[model samples]
Target: MMSTRLEPIQIGAPTGRLSDWVIAPMHFNGFAGLPTTRNESVKSPKFSCFGHQWRLLIYPGGDRESSDGCVALGLQNTTKESIEVETKFIIKHPHGGGDIRKGWDKVARLSPKGSAVVGDVGSARGYNNFALRSTLLDYLFDGALIVEVHMRTNKPGQQSAPFVPENPAFQNMLKDFGNEETADVKFEVGGTVESAKGRRKRAKTPTNTFYAHHYALRWNAPTLADMCKPGEVSPTTITNVRPEIFKHLLYYCYGGKIVEGDLQSDAKDIIEAADRFGIVSLKLEAEACYVDTVEVTLDNIVEIVTYADSKNLALLKEHCMDFLSSANKIEAAEKVSFDDIPSHLMKDLMVAFARREGEGSGNGDTLSSMRVSQLRKLAHEKGLSVDGSREMLIDAIKDDEEGGETES
Candidate 1:
């Protein structure tokens, strides 16, 4: 099969929430793996913005008052004196279109105490219910919550729009991209991947071929460019992805957007192909679509979670955990055949199960936060003696699981 390179797109700088006034990013990496009890929170490092010391505190599960659905946020006046400021949070939605909620423009009189936002901890002036977990899951990318805080600042974000000089001649440079008139690059798709380095081993007697310009191809997909070195005249052979899928990827890289219908057809495949080509945006779209559109249930939870963990798709894994938490944990554990799941990911499932049922944090020696009832129930079910303190109960369970003595 042969196809020409797609036309260029008009991609520009981001046009969502402005980041000039305050660019404090709250990066909660591996949020799904670090299971926390509802109301339990983590703090981003203190950042300086608007000539003030500020820190972002996020409750991964939910707010202190209502931990069921809301993921709350808090901003502290780290300086000595109190300050009254209007605030808004722009959740950099993982799936792409940022979730910027209106009417959250809160003007609070924040004080300096034990990282105090209002009168005291859990008092007024803090972000009470910043976002909901159900909605946030769709926003998250790779199980990370990336948020940008914008404050009412004395200075305007920008004095004037930056200038973009245009010359009709610039487009002409790429005009020959799809034209065989001078296209300098060739791609052969569908073959075997080299196991050692994870790159495709050039197929013997390649069949499928595509044409593209060297500069355009190199800029869009570097792996392909690297293979077609500076002076090489041979076609860069690729394997593992279908030629049709490559067309979508190549088109998107050249400034085109993939249609929703194509993503709906084979989002998982697209996600894998996009990731392989270092296409972050497409990967995020497929991931977000799969979690948002696909129905998650006990029957497919194991398969999905396993695939997610393998790909390091934290956002999808988090969504899977949310579904399992809502479903019966006992039944979910039974339906989750440990044999299919890799040894490493089994711990995540157990931790999520324990977190939902017992409100436990991620698995470790720090199982003290887990409710005694949940631990005792698990221990009793394992036919182990449940006569001990919280630490002792944890040790017993850990021993059983580690020793491979516990049943699925």
Candidate 2:
């Protein structure tokens, strides 16, 4: 028989209400095959505990002649430094009453030179005869076993300082800086100028000018910093952007608050300008304002969802999907011209819709309710083929909906 010694499994840091810290659960699979000799031992991968690397060593058979029939377990400090910790080891009961053995706690001083052998440290009792080899098998769940370790510092708790809110005086000081008139850069933006008289185009483009300090622009907009070279002194012309949208972008750069009113009509333009100029915070704020203030209705859901996908705005996409997945709204969602929407977005929307339908609401089964011809039409609209049987077509539709490549 192969030695039942378990391979170490690495796990991520644990999460929960930690008195101090918890270790991710370690699982030992195929427990029945664990080595039954004194020479072999199962060890856990090194995990972070009390700011030091540590591993759990388990001798399924026994670690020595004295530990004949019982399993032996110990904690080893794997680093060069000494660590002091209060630790507990738990072996969950397989049939589900409680731990296989009552857990024991120990205040241990472990070092690179030696391990804190359970039940052996001064007055500290380890689970030496935790279980006999024959009886230990009963604690295995589905031929697997799990162990968890909890650790905390040996130090006394200290009092924490109280929290303080920001000062209003500091806010006033910042507002004064924003209103300063010593601007060093000028931006000339949007108005059509005559290009050629015969073509009925204006020869000179009409534009509005805004002023800002170069330092602020460079600090916030990297693209603007690249375009406005150091020591150069000429007004930079930014064409092809609406004057109002550019105004809002510059306002944000100047620390002016962007109210919902400013974004209601030009949210999309503001987001595009922010993205193009690499103003990440502004882009995020604009996306938030758009989602929070703008209404999602049949008329604009498609446009908004498409824009959200292009910008990778997860919150807006989720909102749009939730709106579209409502039972009363499915018909309106289907009316959307999904042709221009991204394939991935379409797939997500379809999957979400299918799940909602599958929940067995009064809306009859989604697949059975729709005619074969309608299903084919829907597939064809989504750039999928209609050349298969009804079941095959449904499967293909589901495959596409779930982001799988359509089988040829």
Candidate that scores best on lDDT: 1
Query: What's the lDDT for candidate 2?
Result: 0.65
The candidate that wins on TM-score is: 1
Q: How many clashes does each candidate structure show, in the order listed? A: 6, 16
- Each model's TM-score? 0.41, 0.40
lDDT of 2 by residue, 1-408 (tens): 777877454232123312555655767788779887884788888888666787777778877643678887666777777655667777777667657544435445555544454544432224556667777677787888776766665432221236687667535533544233656667778754322122433325467776666666786787876667544567788865677777777767756677878776677778878877867668767776878887888777888887677676655775687677773656775777667667666645665576566643235547533544476688778887554334556787777877754443
Which 10-residue span in candidate 1 carries the lowest summed lDDT? 10-19
User: Clashes in candidate 1: how many?
Assistant: 6
TM-score of 1: 0.41
Off by over 4 Å in 1: 1-177, 191-207, 217-219, 346-408
RMSD of 2: 16.7
Give me the displacement of residue 308 in model 1, in angstroms. 1.8
